[model samples]
Target: MIEVKNTGKPDERRDFPRGHLDVLDLTGLNFGVATFDPGWRWSESLRELAGTDSCQTHHNGYVLQGHLRIRMDDGEEADVGPGDVFVVPPGHDAWVVGDEQVMVFDFAGGMAEYAKAKG
Candidate 1:
């Protein structure tokens, strides 16, 4: 098991809409850290990352700050705020809830098995 302390490693930047993202921890678990800048929006192309309706994985995370809106493939949505812990299943999509920057710790690397279903 590897422990990741946010303070130790420098965040790697990735381009997003209206803002940017710092991605880390993509070694084995496929899991990574994401820091969303204010008013940030994920690329629509990433919608494909949602896998498929049947593909499912359990995701647990804590919101460091700000809020986020999670939209499931079935059109279900949830608004998450600071200090909130969330679990996301398969067939879902998410985005920043407001203008506040969102810091998220996520675990979903195991879901790669669903890749075949993506096509």
Candidate 2:
């Protein structure tokens, strides 16, 4: 897979929710990479429910910059930062830590699938 970098140029990028994945595509499976800036954060609402967990698929990824935290279904938490790789299970939540931006790459298509699958 190829690697790409985010320039962190605010004016050049479009605005998105504070805790949301801005990009999603099958091609990313081969080049799972992302660059988070300053206040970027992952959504917690995407985690799979326990008893009613859906047929969701999750994959781990590595952090290229800053830091992030993942909260599992059982309430276990983990911290990740530059050069750190992490696996996001089917049932969990995640977000950025402090004011630093977080960059992440993933091999799995990711949580946004629920909406597309439902639609």
TM-score, every prediction: 0.61, 0.58
* Candidate lDDT values, in order: 0.58, 0.54
lDDT of 2: 0.54
Q: Which stretches of candidate 1 lie over 4 Å from their true place?
A: 1-7, 10-15, 18-31, 43-45, 48-58, 110-119
RMSD of each: 5.1, 6.1
C-alpha lDDT of residue 78 in model 2: 91
Return the lDDT, model 2, position 73.
72
Q: Write the per-residue lDDT of candidate 2 for residues 15-115, one digit (tens) a residue.
A: 34453233443334433345555655444232222223332447668787788777777888899898887777776656678887676766565633432
Candidate 1 C-alpha lDDT tens digits along 28-104? 65444566666554334243454343325466777778887877768888988888888887666666776788877
Task: Give the candidate number with the greatest TM-score.
Answer: 1
TM-score of 1: 0.61
* Model 1 steric clash pairs: none
The number of clashing residue pairs in model 2 is: 0
